[model samples]
Target chain A: MLIIHTALHGEARALINHFSLKRQHDMNAFACFRADNIFLIESGIGKTNTASAIGWACGMLNVSSPVMLNIGMAGHTACSIGECYIANRIEDHATQHRYYPPQLVDTPLGSDCLLTLDRPTENYPEKCMVDMEASAFMQAAIRFTTIELCQSIKVISDNTLKPAGRMKDSEVESLLAPHTEAVTGLASDLGQYRAELMDNTGATFSQLTQQWHFTKYQQQQLARLLQRHQALQPDEELIDTIPAWIDSGKAFMRWLDGHLNNLPVRL
Target chain B: MFSTIYVEEAVCDHPRTRKILQHFRGRTVIECRHYGELLNLKAQNFRLQKKQPALILAEKQGKKILPAPAGYHIGARHNYYFSHMLNCIYDCRYCFLQGMYQSACSVLFVNYEDFIHHIRQQALSHHDEAVHFFSGYDGDSLALEPLSLFAETFINDLRNISNIWLELRTKSTQVRSLLALEPWPQCIVAFSFTPEDISKALEHGVPAIQQRLNAIDKLQQRGWPIGLRLDPLIDIEDFEQQYRGLLQQLFSVINIDNIHSISFGAFRMPENFYNRMTGLYPKERLFAFNMERHDGIVSYGESREQDMRNTMREMLLEYVRPSILFPCVA
Candidate 1:
C-alpha cells in the first residue's frame, strides 16, 4: 500500500489524475482520494493538520505497514524551478528537532535537505528546500511504519529569483505535473520491498484453526510454531497430516511441538 | 564503494574525515548533527541495507577502550578491546552484528588520536605484565585498512611497546598495508577460518579459504607472528573429516614456533541475539537447526558442543603446543 500526503489540492492534482483516484465522500476530517492499493490525502496546510491527517488515514485504512510519500511544492534557496529532489534530512525550524530518512532504495531523482517551518517564509536562510509540513508528516508516518517505508519528495516551486507570492495555482500544478512519474516510480520500487517483507511473515494460523479452537495465548504460540516450521522445513506440508487422536487445542499444540522437535537437523 | 556518505557535523572538517570524503568526491554527502540520527533509527532492515550500505564518519565520544569479553583473551593478564569501526564489510549468516546493531552501514570512527591515547594509557598502566589489546571485536580490523588506515597508524605507533600485544582478527585478505611495513613482532594477524564448504555456504563476501591462506603465508614469511582463530566452529555432516582437512591446510602454511596462539569454540550466541538473527533470516539453514539454550546462551546443546570442541582440539594438538592453545568457553 502507498499513501501520498500533500498540503494542497494543487500539488495532489497530477497524482490523483495519474492514479485515477476517486474522492472518498465519507472522509470528512480531510479530503481523501483512493484507488486500489494507493491513497492520497489533501491535508490542508501547517504541521497539525498534516500530522492529524496521517494518523487518521492509517487508522481508517487498517494497514500494519504502508509505503508513505509526502509530495508537494517547496521553496528552495538556489535551485531551479520544477527541479525535484528526495529529502534525505528534515528539520523542524521552530523546535530545532531533526529526522534523517534512510535512502536505501534506488530512485531517479537526486536528494537534498529539507527544512519545515510553521509558516511560509520568503526569506530562505539555509541552503535547503523549505516546506511547512514535511517534518510533521515524517514523524507521524514513521510511527505507523518503518523508517525506510516513509519518505518525502520536494519539487522546487520558488527560489531567490522566483518569489513564493508570485506563484499561481496553475503554476503549482505544472510544477508537480512533470514529477508524477518519479513519485509513482519510487512508490512502485518500495512496494517490492514491502511485498518481500510480508511474504516471509504471512500468517499461517487460519489453516490450523479451522479444526481446533484455541485461546488467544495459544493462538499466538501456534503462529510462532508454524513460522518456525515453515522456515526449517519449507518443502514439507504438515497442516493436513494432523493425527485424528489430537482432539483439543492443547493436545494439538503438544503434538506439533513433538513433531517439530523430532525433525532431523541435517546440516 | 558507497553511493552515499553521512558525515557528523562534529567531524565534518576533521582531517581524517576530509581525506575519506576526497576518495568519494562525487557521492551524495549528507551532514547530520550526529551519526546515530541515521544509523540508530528503529525498524531498519539490516538485510536491505546490506545490499547497498552507506558510509558514516563520526567521532568516538565515550570510553575508547573496554575490557575484553570474558574468556576472549589469549594468555594475558590484562585483555582490552576497542572497535575503531562498527559493522563488518562481510555479511556472514551467523554474524551477531545483524542483531546487535539496527543498521548495516559501516560506521568509521575517524577519531583515532583519542583511541590511541587511551590505549597507550591503559597499556602503560600495566607495564610490568603482558597486556593484550584485541581489535576486530565489533568489526573486522583490516577489511577497510586501505580506506581507514587503522592498522597502519596503530601499528606504526605501538610497534615499540614491548609489553603490549595487538591482535588483528579478520577473514579478509586486505593485508597490503601490513606487508609494506616491517612486521611488528608483538602484533598477531589472526586469521579466522571455517572449512571451504561451510564458508561457501554461510559466509558471504568473504575471501575464499585458499586466498586467505595465501595472505597468511605472506605475513608469516615476513616474520609476523600469526594467530589461528577457529571460533564459532559450525556443525555439519562429516564434521571430523572437514575440520581435519582445514586444520591440516592451515598448519601446512604456519611455522610451529611462530604460532602465537591457537583457539577454537563451537557456534554459540546470546539468546537474544539468536532470536533476533533467526527473525532476520528465518530461512537460513544455519538458523534452522534445532539448537538448545542454556544460561541465556544458545548452542548445539552441551554434548554436541563438547564433542565438536574435543575433536578440533585433538586435531590442533598435532601441530601446536598445548601451552598456547586456548578454548573460548564464552
Candidate 2:
C-alpha cells in the first residue's frame, strides 16, 4: 500500500481530485486515495495528530509494508516561497532534535530538515524551518514499513522568518499544483519498486519452504497451521495451537526418520 | 530464570560466590578480567541481547547509592536510590534500559553488604527525617530474587536501620521471599501495574495482571506495606475506562489501610533513548504514538498528556487519600 499525508486540506484536495476515482475513503482528517499502483493518505496538520492518524490508517488498512509519503507544504530556512524540496531528514525540533536519516529518494531537490513542532513555528528563525506534521507522521509510518518505503516531499510555502499560518489556502494549492504531476509520477515509481521488492522476498521464502521437501499433505498441514496462528486472537487459543502444531510436526518427523533409516543402507 | 553464571575474574573466587555458583547445572563459565572494561563497552547492542541475556556477577567498587532523578521522590525529606543490579529480566518494549545500555546483560553487583552500609550512612546523616531509599531503579527488585537472594539480604540488612525507608519497586510476582518475611513498617513492597490489555501487548515475560494482584494480596495479608505504581501510562483508545477498571480491580482486593502510596506518570522518554529504541524496533506499533519532543523529553503531545494525567488523577483520588498519592514527573 502507498500513503501520502499532507499538512493542508487544499493541497490534499488537488491531489484527491486528480486521483479521485482511486480514492478509497475520506475519513475527514485523513483521506485515503489510490493513485494508479499506489494507495495514498492525506494526513492533516501537526506532528502529534499526524502520527496518530497514520497509525490509525495503517491499522484500519492492515497494510504491513506500505510506502508512506508525507506530501505537504513547509517553511524553508534557505529557500524562497513556491519552491519544492524532497526531505532527506525529518527532525523533531521539539524533542531531542533527532533526525530520521535519508532513504531512497535521491533527488536534486536536496535534503531539508523538517521541524515538526507541537505548535506552528510562529517566530521562525533564520536557521530553522517549520512544518506542521512530517516528523510524527514519518516516525509512526516508518514502523509499519521498511526504510525504503518511507519518503517525504515538502513544498516551501513560506520563508524562514515568516509564519506558516500566513500562507493562504489557495496559495498553498497553487504552490503544489505544478508538482502534482511530478509527485504522482514519483508515487507510481515507488509503488513499482515496492511490488518488485515484495515479489523478490516472497520468492525467496517460497524457495526455502520448497527446499524443506515436505509432501503435499504436509504442505497443506503447514499452511493450515500458519492460518490458524494468524486467525486466533486470544493468547490462550494461540498458545494452545502452538503445541498441537509442534506435536504434529514431531510425529511426522519420527515417521520420516524410520522411512529414511530403512532405505539409507543402499548408499 | 537463567541457567548460567557469567563472572568477572576480579570477584569470581570471593567466599560468598561459591554458594551462588553451585545452584545452576549445565553452567557455562566464561571469565572476564575486569568489570569497568566490559560494562561500559560500546557496540554491544542492548536490544538484541534482551532475547537471551546473560547474568554478570561483579563487585561494585564505590558510590553504591546516589540521589534520585529530579522530581522522582515522593513524601520523603532525603530521597536516594541504589541499584544492586542493572537491566531488567522482563523485556517490556517501552523500557529505557534497552536504549540506555550498550548490553542487555544483567549486571548484579554481588556486594550487597557495601550497598547497605552506604544506605545506612545516608540514613544516619538525616537521623530524624524519613529518608527514602529506592531499589530496582535500574532493574526489577525481586524478579531474579531466587538466584540473586537480593531481597532476602537487603531485608535483613535494612532491619537494623530504623529511620530509613526502603521501596522495593518491581513488576515480578516472585514474592516467595517477601511473603516469608515478617513485614517491616519502613519497607514498602511496590508493584508497577498497567491495564491487562496493554501488559499483554507490550510487557513481554512479565507475569499477568491477575498473577501480580494475587501476589500483592498474599503480601498484604502477611502485613507488608504495599505501593501501586501506574507509571508510563500508555495512551489507548479508552484509556480512562481502562485505568478506572484497573484501579477499581486493585482496590477491591487490596487493603487500602496497608497501601503506602499510589503513583502515576504519562509515557515519556529522553529523545536519544526514544530514537535508539525506535531504531531497535522499527516495526513496533507502540512507538507510533502521537508524541512530541519538548525540552529534551519525548512524550505524548501536551493537550493529550494533560487530559490523561487529569483524568487518571481524578480516578485515583476517588479511592485513595491525597496524601498517599504521588505523581512521577521524571
Candidate 3:
C-alpha cells in the first residue's frame, strides 16, 4: 500500500486525478481519498497537522509496513521555480533534530536537503530547501515502516527571486502536475520491493497448520522448517508430501526435519 | 564508489579528512554533529543500505584500544585490537557485522594519530610481555587501502618497537602498500580463507581463493611473516575433501618457515546476533542448519564442532609444526 500526505488541496489535486482516487466518506478526522492501494490525505499546513494526520491514518489503515510519501511544495535559495527534488535530509527547525533517508531506488529526480520550519520564512539564508511538514512526516511514518519506505517529494514553487507570498494556488497545482508521474513511480518501486520480501513465507505456514494440530512451540518450529524448505528447494512443494500417519504436530515436524536434513548442501 | 559522504563536524576540517575528501571531489558532503546520528537511526535496514553504502568520516573518541576476544590471539599473553574503521567492503552472508550494526555504511575514523597514541600507551604498560595489537576486528584491515592509507602510515610508525606486535587480519588482495615498504619483523599479514565452494556460496565480493593465495605468495617472498586464518569453518556435505584440498593448495605455494601461525575455528555466534541475522536473511540456507545453543552462543553441537576442529587440526599438522597451530574456541 502507498500512502501519500499532501499539505494543500492544490498539491493533492494532480495526484488524486492521476490515480483516480475518490473521497473516503467514513474518515472524519482528516480529509482522505483512496483508490485500489493508494491513499491521499490532504493535511492542513504545518508540522502538527501533518503528524496528527499520519498517526490517524496509520491506526485506521492498520498496515504493518506500508510505503509512505509526502508530496508538496518547498522554497529553495537558488533552484529553478518548477524543478522537483526528493529530500535526502530533513531537519526540524524548532528542535533541530535531523533525519537522513537512505536513497536506494534508481530515480531520475535530483535530491536536496529540506528544512521543516514552524512557519513560513521569506529569507532563504541557507542553501537548503524550506518546507513545513517533511520532518514530522518522516518522524511519524518511520514508526510504522522502514526508512526506505518513508520518503518526501517536493516541487519548487518559490525561490529568493520570487518570494513565498507571491505564489498562488493555481501556480502550486501547475508546479505539482508535471511531477505526478515521478512521485507515483517512486511509490510503486518501494511497494514492489516490500511485496517481494513478504511473498513466500506465510503461504506455506498456513498450508501446514491446516493439516495438523500444532502446539504453540510446534507452530514456530513448523514455520522455520517450511522456510528452510523454501530456501533449499524453491521450485519444489512440501505440502503434498506429508503422510497420513503423522497425527500430531510433533510427529509431523519430526518427519519434515528428516526430509530437510537429507537434502544435499549444494555448496 | 560512494555517492554520498557524511562528515562529522569535529573532523570536517582535520587534515586527514580533507585529504580523503579530495579523492571524492564532487560527491555530496553532508555535515552532522556525530556519525551515530545517521548510522544508529532506528528502522534502518542493513540489507537495503548495503547496496549503496555512504562513507562516514569521524573521530574515534572514548576507549580506542582494548583486550581482544578470549580466543582471538596468536602467541602473545597480552593481546588487544583496535578499529580505525567500521564495516567491511565485502558482504559476506555469515559476517557478524550484519547483526551487530544497524546501518551498513562504512565509517573511517580520520584521527589516526589518536589511535596510534593509545596503542603506544598500551604497549608501554605491557613492556615486559610481548604485546600484540590486532586490526580488522570491526572491518577489513586493507580492503580500502588506497582511500584510507591506513597500512602505510601505521607500518611506518611502529616499525622499530621491538616488544609490540601488529596483526592485519584480512581477506583482501590489496597488497600494493605492503609490498612497497620493507617487511616489519613483528608484524604478521594474516589472510582468511574457506573452501572454494563455500566461498562462492557465502563470501560475497571477496577475491577468489587462488588470487588470495597468489597475493600471500608475493608477500612471503618479500620476507613478510604470513598467518593462515581458517576460521568459522562452514559445514558442508563434503567437509573432509573440501578442507583437505584447501590446506593442500595453501601449503604448496609459501615456504614453511614463513608461516607465522595457523588458526581454525568452528562457526559460532551469540544467540541474539544469530536471531537478528536470520531476520535479515530469512531465505538464506546457511542459517537454516540445525544449530544447538549453549551458554547463549549458537553452534553446530559439541560433537560436530569437535569433529570439524579435530579433522582440520590433523590436516594442518601435515604441513606446519604443532607449535604454530592455534585452535580458537569460544
Q: Of models 1 and 2, which has the larger DockQ?
A: 1
Task: Give the per-residue lDDT of model 3 (tens digit) for B1-330.
Answer: 677899999998999999999999977788888889887997877887787788899999999988999977889899999999899889989899998898988999998988988888898898768999999989999998988999889989987777889999999999999999999978899999999889999999999999999999999999899988999899888999999988888888978899899889999999988988887787899987677899999998889999999999999888888999989886
Cand. 2 Cα-lDDT:
0.72
Which order, best to worst by DockQ?
A: 3, 1, 2
Query: Model 1, A72: alpha-carbon shift in Å?
Result: 1.0
Clashes of 3: 0
lDDT of 2 by residue, A1-267 (tens): 677777666777667777773656556556666765455665666776688778887888786566778888877666777777666445676773433332333344545556666776556645445777777876787678654466778888776455466667677788888788777776676666566434222342354255456567766544433332222221333323232333345454444334322321110
- Give model 1's docking category: medium
Worst 10 residues of 3 chain A by lDDT: A192-201
Writing each residue's lDDT as its tens digit, candidate 3 over A104-200 gives 7777788889999998988875878999999999999999888878899999888899878755667778999998888878888888767755636
Better of 2 and 3 by TM-score: 3
Distance from true position, residue B262, model 3, in Å? 1.3
Residue lDDT tens for model 1, A1-267: 999999899899999899999999998999999999999999988899999999999988988679999998899989999999999989999988788777877788989999999988889867789999999998899888877788999999888898787556677889999988888889998888777666343445776687679999998777767776776678777766788898888898898778877766544
lDDT per residue as tens, model 2, B25-103: 6554445444544445553345544544667788988799999988887688789999998889999988988878766
DockQ of 2: 0.01
Q: Provide chain B TM-scores across all predictions.
A: 0.98, 0.96, 0.98
Candidate 2 retains true contacts at a fraction of: 0.00
Pairwise DockQ winner, candidates 1 and 3? 3
